[model samples]
Target: MEAPIKAPTPGAGGCGTVWWQSGTVYQIYPRSFQDSDGDGVGDLRGITARLDYLAWLGVDAVWISPFYRSPMADFGYDVADYCAVDPLFGTLADFDALISEAHRRKLKVILDFVPNHSSIAHPWFTESRASRMSAKRDWYIWRDPGPDGGPPNNWLSNFGGPAWTRDEATGQYYYHAFLPEQPDLNWRNPEVRAAMHDALRFWLARGVDGFRVDVIWHLIKDEGFRDNPQNPDFQPHQAGINRFHQVYSCDRPEVLDIIAGMRAVLRAYGERVLIGEIYLPIERLVTYYGPGLTGADLPFNFQLIQTPWRAEAVAALVAEYEAALPEGGWPNWVLGNHDQPRIAARVGEAQARIAAMLLLTLRGTPTLYYGDEIGLGHVPVPPERAQDPWGRNEPGHGRDPERTPMQWEDAPNAGFTAGTPWLPLTGDANRRNVDELRDDSRSILTLYRRLLSLRRDHSALSVGAWRGLALPSDLAAEVFAYERIADGETLRILLNFSNQGWSVPLDEGGPWQILLSTHSGRAGDRVERQLRLEPDEGVILGPPGR
Candidate 1:
């Protein structure tokens, strides 16, 4: 069997767990995290200014979204320079300072690595587009027009329309799984692979703990470039790109080799993480861990985000995902991200609390999106203020709603920036800001902070064995229950997925104390045997001795 990644030295009464498994990750969208210079946009230095808040929140690592040099086409996802910081976000010195402060506060730094595509402005793409004879012509995927002067075969961009855009000057069409300005790289080329791997080395040399690779599955494509078949189940409400089944375009087998290559670079720097942004079937997602376990350290399990919020549905998903995890592969969970609707908005305010409990207690590394702790819902973006190209092209499908500025306090602009904020703040700043939640024990922010603290202080919640329990045959159908145990400690987690109250008999142990409850004012209570669950509430219990 392949050896598992080495574990950090264990503490008293704690299991030996890898840093990624034992710690929580907080994702910061750099454009909205904080604005130190009052540029109305967040920067690396602004992130430095906010390190203390993360430290206070008790996350072990911070995964900041792209802050690399880009033209803001897809925000920072379109990189113009692999090794340079964008002037809009600040200089290299600023990033270094952020890293220093994060580390000093015992937090690791994970950068967003967008190797799938680089901005057309990138020197590599610039040279490739310069002339057909340019040495870097093969650096990106370029195809000649077909019989009707159309794109080669058929593939669709995630944003909208055709996957290929014609370069009139060069008489060739370049492929882009996203925006036309973001040209897909030819990972089939060894030079391209080496250079992309070098980008990892560049940041590794600068103390970046790891990378959250964007579109890792889209890095390679089928060699035949066949036209994808139409999806028979495609619905009109879904994104237009879903019209095609993506059979010939993405999630290719060769992509595993590329991810493995990136993994090798990370291995050179001990104990670092490699998080891939893969939205695929559960079985397919785990394959990124590569044969012999040498691929991405975390393939990013997002089932919870995509699965229906019903109890049976979520329970089955959790069980299937756990069963499908490859040996020694670390699991990670993401509730809401910059790409999706906020959890509170997606599952309703009541269920979001239960979702937070599930995310933390589940056996995996939990990724907390910025502002989720404060129950930030989606904020609308007016037509004129809409900056996302996705929303611009697709009309109603913009991500701006979920990418609003962090609401730190009730002051003028929610303390995110001095100037008019980039994206509108979500909810009344006075009612939803972190400053307000700090003193409200019943707030979502309090639940998140308490959950993080619980996970950090107890191995049972963080790096423990998970076992889904079957509910009583006569009990209500809207509850999910599980147990996590480690180092002689155990926690029984129960959640009522519906509005109605529920009840379950205690396990065959003794003297259990209410370690935590989603409903405020119930923790610290003792449960003799029969445990009553509050409406839409979740609870975590531990033996009195534990």
Candidate 2:
């Protein structure tokens, strides 16, 4: 068993600079962002080439997805070398140059750090599997098969398979919470904890502003190796395929200690932030911040990403999240990512724009997935062309649809590649590229830019407390209304999620100023008395001031 580390004091000041508040983060999926080497895959250099575009979008930081050295088992989530950039992406110098260029553009860079597991090809795992007496043997979870010569327990992989992989050479089974190629790291070991800590320091020393920790909750597993209880209501599509609940398998109390250790390392660097990717329910997710213990600065609020597009559902989710946050803890919002279907596809193309407005107007730091600004829909990837392991294993339903190459121009491959892209580019890429949408005032891209600029210009939208407003009965379930109050200023935001126009009821006693609107036809006379909203429209009403 790994030695236990003492937890750090909560709210300890001077742990670098925490700047996540009031910040807009743009997420970049490196493999599909841009390809500078003409290798048909996006790389660090490709991202560097687009720094000006990101800066122009008015985002405070760019959260680049995993680009670490890996065997690509689960993309870059399975880290083979924590300190180096994968050759496919570029070299260390390439990453350094990307960082320098981003900083020059006033864009902070936050890299994705996968601390939960390492690639089977990783040296640590290689040594651990060599022999039972190896020094690093305890760095991974291993056990002898049961009497029936199967895995020790009934653990299941998130990708639809047994969680244990048996090694013929060693006659032992290794634990892999995801894929067999990605083995769960034994955080129970002190050496493993120290090594992971050193990895963070390595990147911070290179001038990264922060880290987006991948699967932070899965870092430490149950030490007893007990079988997870069968989940009676388990659905095939649900992430939890195991017959049992994951109480002991994941989110262990021991994980908090590892987070504290990570925080200690980041504390050494000034102003560095850690945002964790946790897929737990709100109550459990909030615990990552520690009632009084120091852990990740932002645990990543994914409620919006997973919830349906209904108004009441979204509103209740927002309220619940805002209420569940620990005292002094900040909240974050992620609407789309590489793992899930595009919000445009989930909701409609029109509704996607409204979603963007809601995300920007909501309280907390907003993270925009790549291509979300243009309301990009999921591009279908045929079985033969699919590259995602999950997609390969489970045809037609994996994340390949969302991981297609980006649409940058009306060119052949959406300007993502000069050659055929590794994955098929969407047919709508011609219309959704940056060149076509950036200048169009009616385009979703422009709407996002304007909203972000407006949010930056107004403090009420950034750090204000959100209050939900009752919507008129005529409005569809797609419409959502809310008010943000800060410093005695109230900003009313109305979003119509439907494709049909609806007249919005106004408070007769108050005069509202139209600060912004997404509708191309709604720019005429301001709302002097009552407000009328067009189909797929969004309007921001600011209190009389300026």
Candidate 3:
């Protein structure tokens, strides 16, 4: 609960102040975090009101989802105005106040920058679509219709439908890799690149610590507008239209130049960090941190968010990511977020605590989604009640299941809104609210607090080197075991992912101390000692020779 002890250096790489090294980041879905005006939606003021809660949780930074002026087409991701806050969230002064308060609590703020596209309502797009040679027309990607009066090429949006839309006024089809209303920005243009860089400077000048670049890899498209090849294993959701491999559509080699330009702007401000959202293979993902170019400080690692719940699989992934990290590049982990289902829902309620342990103890920076520490699960929304644009298009298969509002209290609207919430509150809101579980020592929040405290107190758990241990096949499938070594201190972390009991051989030749355990049990020194782990149990053991 005490304030975090300030490290000696504020921006040095390593355990001290590497943008993301060993830091705990709390993600705030602004519209669902809290409502300041009883308007049934959260805003910047709501986040300011909850700073103490974040401080108590020991998080070092807060990654707030987009709050720019928008049409609410895709929540805040579809930016209508980049320079000011949406009236719904509050005034620009409110954002400044939020930033000041966050820093006062020693928490850094990272804004979500959606550079891939902007809402069609954006002024730049409006004028660009008004007429040919309008000076801003080239700001966005506009192409001629295909030979058969269809789309320009065989490109598909991640959300659904054609990636291009025809404009009756100009007889051109504009590109939109996501929603039809959200058109992709043409990064190939020098003027466009300069404008986006100015946008970055605008926030850095406002004292924003950094940005979480959304869809960083999708910034550049194939200049020739080539058709993507058909995917061999396309499913129903991605097939029928043009389920193709997007070799030329995204992740172009030219993205590095744009990243360098962005980095150059950040370098002007001492100690700025840029975390990119790039989903690719481990080898390709690390390349975002270019060999000689100024790459991102941390590429948001979504492996934990996408991996299955098997112990061996997770262990292998952890090792692979650590190995794949580029030199001078710090690794990061995200277990849950506004766009994905909560880890508690993905695994199970019983395993939530263990997942938290694994997350905090892992050898990298950890980002915890809002309300995740309380073991919040996704609330199933009926098709008619869904608000996600993707869900609106497909009706049932989109992410509406995970984007529900946060549960703050057991009162009406789960203390998220006094009026009707934009989304429905979950059925478990009454019991899962913060006030109900904060006092319970065994609650998931309390477990998170303890885990964070342990991480902060011990160097081995935070900035240590991880070494995977091999166990029996059956035990390996259900139990994850790894050792962390730093500053001559070694800590062994063992977690049981399943509900069944599992055992691992412990080194009995030397004294082994039980530093922490989710289950109320103890371990003593013994040669070849057997550890009987209960379901969802976790134990952190001190160094073998300590």
Candidate 4:
């Protein structure tokens, strides 16, 4: 195995926090980030070419989405070979260079490890399907048909149909939580667990700092294959997955044992981090931390994405998450991802700036989605150009709008490729490209860089204790404020969610200066007594010395 990267020693300076806790993690959708070749698709070299930008932007790490060998059924989520990079992405040597270059630049590399399922074309699945008595037949979840000769049970696939697919030769059904092309692995099998653990070791041996395990909660299913209870609260507007309670299909208690095993493997690798992609409510979500915080280093808190964006609501959400964390469990936050809509599209550009401040100033780790820093909203995709399977399977809900190619420059195809882009580019790509935004003093990209720089400079912002500032009943609905304290330094972040100006009282004495502002050009303003804020603005305040 490659020698583990030595951990940074903690001290009163910014190094006091562990690497994962001290800085932001930026997620890159490889296929849309940059295309080095003229094939209209991004490759590993494309990502290698962007490491300098990430380091310059001040993010400490990058969490790349899956690029494993696959048939592209679910866009790399369906892994056909766990240990090899698909030729579409490049050779294994390209992956090694990515790791070496990222580490050389002092940036941690985290890969998306998809363990719940594999492409049906994978060798293991192919061998398992040869006949009912195939030694590997038990490697996947298979059962005889239900009494009616329909699906084994009522469990629905996340892609919008029965989760089971009949095997013509074997005279049985195999379960898949997503597309039928992707078959769920039988985690209950010891051999299956051993093989998947080996896959992780393969990457760790190559010097990856960590993994963001995909569908972590779906690792183990209910052994009985029972039908899920109906969700009474379901509505016509919700996705098909919400039609049931999902008790039998996923998030089973047994999954904790499986997680414990995975955690053990990561523990063997010095200071390696494990982040689980879980979408459970805060109550159940905290359980993923396992007893004494051994399950996942970070459970991927997505409450911010699902919560209503009102000031009072967001404050309460933060409070609940803080209270729900296990005693020693670390917290993390995410605003957008390849699977979700862009923050700018959900809330207008004015508030995307505030969202950036909120994410950075929060108590725990924050993950920034690529292009979100430049205020990229959903790029409308025409029906003929739609590429996402989810959008193709379900109309009006496709993620293609949010997964468009990144706008790097004003050149053809927004400088993402020399050939036709695999996806469409945003309408504002001409004016909002990174090359243009970098030089604009008041661009959202500048705001993001400023916020990140502040985190590195202030111990309080990077690893401080957080306390929500109390607001009077009326103002509470219109304003959200919080204080972060560490290293004898105190910093306050105040956000105005409303469109009108308001005056908020300073409970404590302060001749505080504005450290940064979302509207830009407001830095270094003195504040004392009641501070007046402009409409739709957010500001960070610190003692006057700086």
Candidate 5:
């Protein structure tokens, strides 16, 4: 097992630097992480039970997916109560205990705050739908039918079909950017903004360190409810939501103001973070940092998840993203999340090691998906066993594969649950589990532990200045190189993106020390001239000796 990591001394990197700036965050899908109840689903206590694992893994924080009261329509995304814990997960006291324990380990707790919409069963939504003139009627986005007696405009649900669902009782339609069960809140209403901000304060007062605001870009809609322009580049294979450019529906200029307001609420509690879940292009994404950096502390950078896994592609993406950041804005990176396919499945298993090195060494906060540390690939969910409403509504785009139960051991159900897992475990769970890999010197888990430890120990890797180095002429397309320097310390990361070995020439005159290698075969090796890299290998080099 990896040795446990002690909490960093206060202001270890710098006195004023935020914990998130130098610390790593791990995203845990609660239902898939662990199951203490033996009820086939993961819960708060289960996550608490695994706090040691996270602390040992050396992550600085835990960003738990939604565990609030819900009707399970979109799992916990369709929240019925922002303050109450879902019985499926645990109670409010259980969440308190989780926060207490996580803090004890010096791990920050970031809750998934779904502010874009609430479950249709939410008390506010229920009362809003009760009557057209009800006091809460304006809390949600309700619109009259179009002139042709059809639903409002050409808006489309992210899942499928119309974004508007007719309320037969009130003879009006309610808007839902995602599912009909998830009714979008009308942020145009001042009361709605106040209520949502209050929910944030509720958590902050309870010792929650921060929040990952869900669908933050979708908080506001165009006042005129105008039609989105048709996408000229629409492909038949793409989801229907992509048929139109989401111009009027989402990423409105007004959403930034809403995010700023939320940030202000978080600021009331010292040093708390507000991370916006925005998926816009890098140019637009930086705007969420606000015109004066008053918006989200970190607008999640998902370019790594979407970018092509090639040396040149990733290198260019990094350069573009770094160039686009607003002044004083902090950047964050994500490799895999609950929504996307696993990194192991995206790039082959060998390359995942390379990806891990890149993520940890990059000059930003890295949010790691739970199972990626052990190289968990996607698990195929059978048709009948599928649970994602999005997948059920639209065939073939299911996230169940990526959200499967974490493989902890080689037991039945992979030790995720005493009962049958809510979703299936990866096929190689027996061989590719935490217990099996923990002791393997060269295993991916060991690599992750070492990289995280190195990041913690070196200011250069934690809060350093990053610069992409020009690759040698012959190795330009196959290698991605970068140097990080901070506080008189410098480190170089070299990644081989190709499947063929290359003898990378070192012209900078470096007697380089291999600090860490993906293959676990090169640490402590001294390179006098050309450094030889095996296929799909990556290595971190210490500063040249005197």
Candidate 6:
């Protein structure tokens, strides 16, 4: 077994830096994380019951997906009552208890805030659609039909087909970016903005540390309601939304101002963070930082998820992203999320270890998708058990494969639920699970624990300035290397993206120990002038002459 890591002194990075700046955030999909009370679904109490596990795993924060009152059309993404908890996830009291339990464990709670749209069942939408002359009618986007009596323009829903749905009673059509049941909110409406802002305050009042704002870029659309231009290189196999470049539909100029407004609200309350879920390019993504560093505290960076898994490709992506950050901007990394495939599934089991090493050691706050640490692979979702609206509409677009239940042990349902799990467990759970791997010295769980423990112990890995290390041109093809420097302490991270042993000269030539390694057996080994990396291995090395 790996040696236990002692607690590191708090505030080691510095006093002015916020906890999130140097800490790790773990995303918990409540419905898939654990099912407390065994009602066949996960609830707030289920998450509360697992706080000890998260705290033990060394996570600094827990970002739970939406738990608000919803009609479940788009799962919890379509909110009906911003201030109330859904019956499936328990009551408001249950949510409070979760906050209490999480805080007691010193783990910050980050909630998923869906500000872009609301369920058609929402009272506000109900009233707004009651009549064209209704006072709340303008609260949502409702436009008249086109000349041919079809959708206003060529815009399409993320789920598929037209973005507009006609309401026969009013001869007008409402817009929804995703599901028709989820109508787009008129963020252009001042009252809507205020109400949504107040929703943040509602949780802030109840002790939420921050929010992972869902689809923040989709909050504001083009003012003219113009058609999104078609992609010149569109493909038949890609998402339908991709047929258009989203020129007029998303990432509009006004989004920056709206994001800054959210930041202002967070700043009013001390130390709270706002993380926007943006899938734009690096150049445009940085703009979410706002004009004067006043936008999202951490506009979620997901380039790693889309970039090819190769040394040169990843290094280039990292450099491009770092260089693109606006002044005073902070960076964050995400390896996986509810909407994407798991790391292990994407890069194979062996490379997943290297991916973990890179994630925890990289110069940014890292968000760990639930079940990633234990090396959970994607669980196949049979047609009968499929749950994602996107996949149901588009055969290959479903995210159900990645939204499986957490494997806590070798029990039936992987100990996630007593009755039946909302999603099937990856059959490998019996051999690869927290209970089975926590005691195994070379298990992925142990590697993650060690990496997190090392990150906690070293300020360099947490808040240090990252600089890429130069390798001979011919020798740099399959290896990625960088240095993290803090308070004169320098650490080098070397990763071999290929499944072939590679060696790099340790030019500094002094006493150096492998602080941590992707291959567990290789960790803590002493090294010198020549460093050889096992196939698909990654290692963090203390500076020479130390």
Per-residue lDDT tens digits for candidate 5, residues 200-238, read 999999999999999899999999999999999999889
Where does model 1 exceed 4 Å of error? Answer: 1-16, 473-476
lDDT string, candidate 4, 203-310, tens digits? 999999899999999988888989999999999988888899999999999998889899899889988889999999999999999987779889999999999999
Least well predicted 10-residue stretch by lDDT in candidate 5: 1-10
- lDDT assessment of candidate 3: 0.82
Candidate 1, residue 43: lDDT: 88
Error of 2 at 486 (Å): 2.2
Please provide, for model 3 over 400-486, each residue's C-alpha lDDT reduced to its tens digit, 9 standing for 90 to 100.
666677887889888888787877877889998888888887788878887888887777677766677777788888899887766
* Model 4 TM-score on a 0 to 1 scale: 0.97
User: lDDT score, residue 536, model 6?
Assistant: 90
lDDT of 2: 0.83
Residue 439 CA displacement from its true place in model 1, Å = 1.9
The local distance difference test score of each candidate is 0.88, 0.83, 0.82, 0.89, 0.90, 0.88
Q: Which of candidates 1 and 2 reaches a greater lDDT?
A: 1
Off by over 4 Å in 5: 1-13, 544-546
Candidate 6, residue 394: how far the Cα is off, in Å:
0.6
